[model samples]
Target: MSDDKPVHTPLEIKLKLSLERQPLPNISYYQRLVGKLIYLTITKPDIAYSVSIASQFMHSPTMEHFNLVKKILRYLKGSVGHGIIMKKNESTQIIGYCDVDWAGNYIDHKSTTGYCTFVGGNLVTWKSKKQAVVARSSAEAEY
Candidate 1:
């Protein structure tokens, strides 16, 4: 990428476990793998849901969780070309969409908030986060 000329071939990448991923025998490797995948969410929106679910068990990931993360990575490897592309637009409109999952968190009984912002037809930003306070109703969840 440093070179001015565009590279015709896809960039080769090597995914490796980080230092934080090691040193815990009881912990599952899925936590670290999911963390990496979540970081990639900025470029790839397809794996957002899977990564989010896998990340919920970061505090106590299991062997099952690790296998799921590995599967996600394998899926990504086979679909590396999948990603969002920003194109030249004719209009300048900023749009936002918001959604809430009522009492979605099984652990804390909290709702999850999701939103996506777009610049014209391009997806500029998005996030899925657990709400801090418990809501009494779906309307309250959005508020």
Candidate 2:
């Protein structure tokens, strides 16, 4: 994959992934790759959501999951220098923004909540994770 062309996106838009698909023989490899990607997310929040999705299939990855992982790697290769940079500021206030997708996961019908916190004009933390319980309505999901 050294010569593989870089991709602009880590995961395809509106991608529907499932666990019912055929499992890959080399599950260990997939797990290792996902573990590394998870570590990378510490500095590269942009890839956090895609990496989280890939991590879900660590126990039973399919070719589709592997392809998505490769796409993430390609994206990393292209944007190797991309990362959050903190600049010194006099202000110390922290601001946060959050949102949720209504039933974003087609497989489980669970919404995904995403939030980011900024301190002194620099992004300090962010996360995107699936909700534990299914929301009955979009308002509930957003809440």
Candidate 3:
């Protein structure tokens, strides 16, 4: 991946991860890679969602899943030196923003929600996860 062109994003926005893909023979390596990524998420929120998606296939990964992991690595390579920054400031206001894609999961029709929190105009925490329950409408998903 050193020579491969780096992407600005960790994962494709329209990507639909499914379990119908061909399964791989060996999965020990995939699990190890995902485990490291999970640890990385503590400091790199940008790759948190993509890493979460990739880690889902730890039990029985496929070529598509492996490719997604590669994409994440490439993204990391391109985004070196990019991470949360804390600067001296007096602003103390807390702000948050969140959004969801209604019925994003092709398998179960569950929505995926992403959120971020900022303190004094600086990001402090963020998360992206699939909803446990299916949402009937976009408005419901937002709520």
Query: Which candidate, 1 or 2, has the higher TM-score?
Result: 2
What digit string (tens of lDDT, one per residue) describes model 3 on residues 10-112?
9997798778889977689888988998999988898998898888678989988999999999999999999888887999999999988889877689898
Over 13-103, each residue of candidate 1 has an lDDT whose tens digit, in order, gives: 3222222333335564555666788899879876776677667768866555565566677667667576898989797899999888787
lDDT of 2 by residue, 1-143 (tens): 89999988888889998777788989999999999999999999999999988998888899989989999999999998899999998999999999988998888899999999999899988989899999999999988
lDDT of each: 0.69, 0.92, 0.88
**Winning model by TM-score:** 2
Residue-level error in angstroms, candidate 3, position 72: 0.4
Per-residue error at 46 for model 1, in Å? 2.8
Best by lDDT: 2
Stretches off by above 4 angstroms in model 1 are 1-28
* lDDT winner between candidates 1 and 3: 3
Better of 2 and 3 by lDDT: 2
TM-score, candidate number 3? 0.92
Winner on TM-score (2 vs 3)? 2
User: How many pairs collide in each candidate, listed in order?
Assistant: 0, 0, 0
Task: Give the range where candidate 3 is weakest over 10 consecutive residues by summed lDDT.
Answer: 99-108
